[model samples]
Target: MTEEPVGTLAGIARHAFPKAPMEVLDHVDVSVEAGLAGDFRGAVKPGGRGRRQVTLIERGDWEAAMAELGHAIPWQERRANLLIDGLDLPQVAGTLIGIGAQVVLEITVECDPCSRMETIATGLKAALTPDWRGGACSRVRRGGRIALGDDVVILDPLQGQLL
Candidate 1:
């Protein structure tokens, strides 16, 4: 079979509170048990405790969503843990993606926008609704430190292969 294209991890961010602003970071430690180190979600919810152990979104998709809303907004406003480039994040549930050398994540569901998005900007929630623009909720599978510029691989579970 033909090889699948690889993407890149362009950015990372985390927050200390549920509604706190996101703080962008250069790197983060991910684990099957801790999700992202120092993240509030990790501390409060713990890894393997919830489907949203990690959240991922595509930079392109974020931009598109902003354009649809007629403005440009910081990606951190979306509150995703990782920002990816050059990959169309799968909206389908159960899609597995590998970040960097380690850190395998299984996409559990579409991260639908919450009222907080509407609070970020009027019409933001509606803008993020179409095309899975709100990003995806994921659970950590294999853990490791993920950094900016790390390679992203799409793993095909059906074939037990990495693309």
Candidate 2:
């Protein structure tokens, strides 16, 4: 019944292909079928059925991890699609996040820290291990063209609260 203005979309990025350099976007056309326009993952799953269509990371959490590591790594290295700020993201799956005015994403799973994270720093993976600091994976439920700083709301907080 209560919707929370959880955060704001701070950044957006996409990669053309596996291991490709991430391209920072000022605005992106989100699609239920393609996730972010020109994103490689979208091309792999054209039907819009992939649960990991989009990935999100909390800016606060990312900062915390970087602080612990005593380094200033950019959020892009985490390889998430959207960077959010304000409140912590829900650790559980099934929560719905509404972005801007039209884009909606259903959380599907934890964006677990991968081995590549260790390549960035000695303890980077562990720094992002506790909580969902590594971010989350989701499936797009609604589509829209969104830009940085768009309002983000927690539309289904009841499904999962911050862990």
Candidate 3:
């Protein structure tokens, strides 16, 4: 069988937490401003309505690997589903990219992980530590709907415009 040709940036993995599935969203709305992903009073999941939890991306995380491994070697933070490779997104996490028909978000900020992942990854901390070093996070820019097989198209990459 012929493999489907992925466009410019490869869409490696598509993921959603057990509590929050992509289907819960209708269209991801990424805000180009005002987003946070670290521990704060208003950043917990089971908190009251005004605040939410901040997301994370480890350097060698499995989620980063599933996105793309073509560049920057295999650091844990690189295993994200929507690999916005080559873009320095320090202040742009709350934005949105329309992936094919759906919108894959870039909403989280970096939050370093502690010992919990060691249990989830089954004692792979030594191999995964480097990946977690470069952490990541995201917020629901616009929550509506998303799913697997959705194509990812970077609205604006790190290097300005594509040649």
* Candidate that scores best on TM-score: 1
lDDT tens readout by residue for model 3, 1-163: 6543333222233224432312222223222232222113223344333212323332224444333332333322233333333233343454434444533445445544455544434443444445333445554333333333455343443542221
Weakest lDDT window of 10 consecutive positions for candidate 3: 30-39
lDDT of 1: 0.85
Relative to the true structure, candidate 2 reaches a TM of 0.89
Mind giving the per-residue lDDT tens digits that candidate 1 earns over 1-163? Answer: 7868889999899987788879999999998776888777753252335688788888998998888888888898899999999988878888899887878899989888999888889988998888888899888888898999999988988885775
Q: Arrange candidates by TM-score, highest first: which order?
A: 1, 2, 3
Error of 3 at 96 (Å): 4.4
Cα distance off (Å), candidate 3, residue 18:
9.7
Output the better candidate (1/3) by TM-score: 1
Q: For each predicted model, how many residue pairs clash, with residues at least 3 apart or on different chains?
A: 0, 0, 39
Give lDDT per model, in order: 0.85, 0.85, 0.36
Candidate 2 deviant stretches above 4 angstroms: 1-3, 44-48, 157-163
| Candidate 2 lDDT tens digits, 61-142 | 9999999989998899888899998857777788888888888888999999998989879999999988888999998888
Considering TM-score, which of the candidate structures 2 and 3 is the better prediction for this target?
2
